[model samples]
Target: LLGRVDDVMLVSGHNISTTEVESALVSHPAVAEAAVVGAADQTTGQAIVAFVILRGTATESEDLVADLRNHVGATLGPIAKPKRIMAVAELPKTR
Candidate 1:
């Protein structure tokens, strides 16, 4: 009820909230902020994709990405894990 219907993603026939995924990503120590979206996937119907801003003290690396994915899988379920995670300097904003 907090977010709009558009914020909900039909991933593998399961309704997953973007906010829920974002929260899970942000819970990681290295993550400062996160945004999640569902992308077209032939296999799953929709795949979770994430863009993350790292904490000032955190460095971006392949290992860190793997750790973040593992963290989300552990926090939520494996189905909630992001298919891809990209480190971004900033997220686009709108008024």
Candidate 2:
């Protein structure tokens, strides 16, 4: 995504910082870890989505999602807010 940034987003517009998303997800108390992806979106043109693994006893909640969204917005501004966030048991790994 560094060299082929333009090839990454097949949709219109670009304002999100992929690196920042990576950082923000890790910053969440509920998120033990995360991986960020670019999802095709009609509205944002290219929506950022986060697939996260939460810490022990931390379940996915609407409040967590909203808080994370707001955190990202406050730190990186609205452009960096993810369109969707999915809390998975674990992120798919590359063997």
Candidate 3:
């Protein structure tokens, strides 16, 4: 379903869905939740950027960033891996 939508981003000519990236990010043990957005890029057209909330015990660091990237890469391939991953205290929500 995500693969067929106009909301899907074209990254280096590859279709990338924000839903798929979020799913991949949360699959990592350290991640509790994830939100993904597409950022404009001259080379890739759009780049995947991820904001993540980590589990209580997980510490945010460069090593963790690399690990999460590797985790998503393993699950969704290199193309689906986030170009930027940032740990956030919370994701704003609207009811």
Question: Which window of ten consecutive residues has the lowest lDDT sum in model 3?
Answer: 1-10
lDDT of each: 0.92, 0.76, 0.89
lDDT of 2 by residue, 9-81 (tens): 4224655656677688788777788888787787766788888888889888999889888888888777778
Q: How many residue pairs clash in each candidate?
A: 0, 0, 0
10 residues in a row with least lDDT, candidate 1:
1-10
Error of 1 at 60 (Å): 2.0
Order of candidate numbers by TM-score, starting with the best: 1, 3, 2
Which numbered prediction scores highest in TM-score against the true structure? Answer: 1
Q: Estimate, for each residue in 1-95, the C-alpha lDDT of model 3 and write its tens digit.
A: 23536458889999888888889898888999999888999989999999999997998899999999888889989988888999999998869
TM-score per candidate: 0.92, 0.80, 0.89
Which residue pairs in model 2 clash with each other? none
TM-score of 2: 0.80
Question: In terms of lDDT, which candidate is stronger, 1 or 3?
Answer: 1
In angstroms, what RMSD does candidate 1 have relative to the true structure?
A: 1.2
